[model samples]
Target: MSLKPGNIVEGKVVNITKFGAFVEVEGKIGLLHISEISNSYVKDVSEYLKENDIVKVKIVSIGEDGKISLSIKQANLEEQKKSCKPEEVDWNSKKRKTNSIDFEDTLSKFLKESEEKFKDLKNYKNLKNGTYAKKKNR
Candidate 1:
């Protein structure tokens, strides 16, 4: 089959290098770069793909000489669709249980605690400066 730029195909890894893997697709070779392997950061290419491993890859680029570049990330996304079933939800199926305090109440408590701390600090500063005095009732 003729490989196109948008086609996703299965290929056997023929060789692996620090930069990428050379995969053979229908007797034609393609470069599966390390960056194209996954969405996550890959510290080492051998950890995921190895020589002689068959993997599904998406055609990324086609050069003037027909050298193909492929991506494993695209292939995995396609495979995940096939193995997983669609989830359907009924509005009354189950009620979601909430396990948290009221947001406004939490904020008010935090503010009160902060004001007390600030007043304590101000009192300490005034006492250190010899200006602290007790207020008397008239």
Candidate 2:
């Protein structure tokens, strides 16, 4: 079958890299990017696939430069992914406003904590170097 977007096809893993694997389908080589290799976080591609292994992949996209992008996860998803579409969101909802406020507050809190830690680190360094004199009772 001709390689097209969303088309599930069988391809041979021609090469494997730290980032991803190259699969040859229909006499054309396509890059199965690391992100597209699996649904979960993949630390190593070799754990899931090996060179010359035949894999079922979904054609993700074909670039204007003749580059083909393939996805094994999408091939597995197929009908399930369509049925599990994310619920529609109201962009102007009150929840979004509250979330933004919460984010800003969290960021300020993080910055304050960071500054306090840095101050303590500086003081500790100074004390270790004998730059800070001990307070004597008056």
Candidate 3:
């Protein structure tokens, strides 16, 4: 089968180096870089692959010089993403609950609280500056 980008193919690990393992896929040998080996840190390439270990890898890219870059971690991740189903959100399903409390009553309470807080702040500011503002007899 013809190898292309995003193609998950089974290949044989013919050689393993400190950096990565070279695998033969469809008679074409490509470099599976150490970074592409796994999602976690790979201290040694030999620990993952033997002299003749079959591995499934994703074709990352192909250079003009026929250099093919492969990835094992990406292959695993892509498979995981494929298996996962996206959650369908029902935007209009949940109806908004109507409040029984009167709007005017709530507004009046908020306004009264705000005015009291403002008056207290003003009194505090005047006291700090050593000046007392005369309160109007309401």
Candidate 4:
């Protein structure tokens, strides 16, 4: 069967390399790149996939030379959207409101928070080192 972009297909992983994995789909071999493995950072491809594992992948591109690029992340995303209920609010659909604060007010708020954090750190260090009781007496 011919593969096209955005087509979801099931493939069995035949080989794996540091860069990507080769999957066999309908008697054809396709490359599932490591970066396309997941939406999240994939430090190790083997950790997420292995040889002989069947995976559902979306065909991202098919080159003139017949190099097929597949994405498991895209397929998973499509499946998740189909199975999950639509979100009530799409936060990304609307532009975020930026509350404009005066520079003076912003600086003062930052300074106040920083002072409180510094005091907490100092108190933590004193307590850890058994110096808090000494300071309390003074």
Off by over 4 Å in 4: 87-138
Alpha-carbon lDDT of model 2: 0.90
Question: Scored by Cα lDDT, where does model 3 land?
Answer: 0.91
Residue lDDT tens for model 1, 13-114? 999889989999888999999898889998889999878999989888899988898999988887787799978878787665587677898999999999
Query: Residues 1-138, candidate 3, lDDT per residue (tens digit)?
Result: 798998999999999999999999999999999999988899999888897899999999989999999999999998999899999988979665687667899999999999999999999998866643334422
The candidate scoring highest on TM-score is 1
TM-score of each: 0.73, 0.57, 0.63, 0.61
lDDT of 2 at 26: 97
Identify the superior model by TM-score, candidate 3 or candidate 4: 3
Of candidates 3 and 2, the better by TM-score: 3
Model 2's TM-score against the true structure: 0.57
lDDT of predicted model 4: 0.91
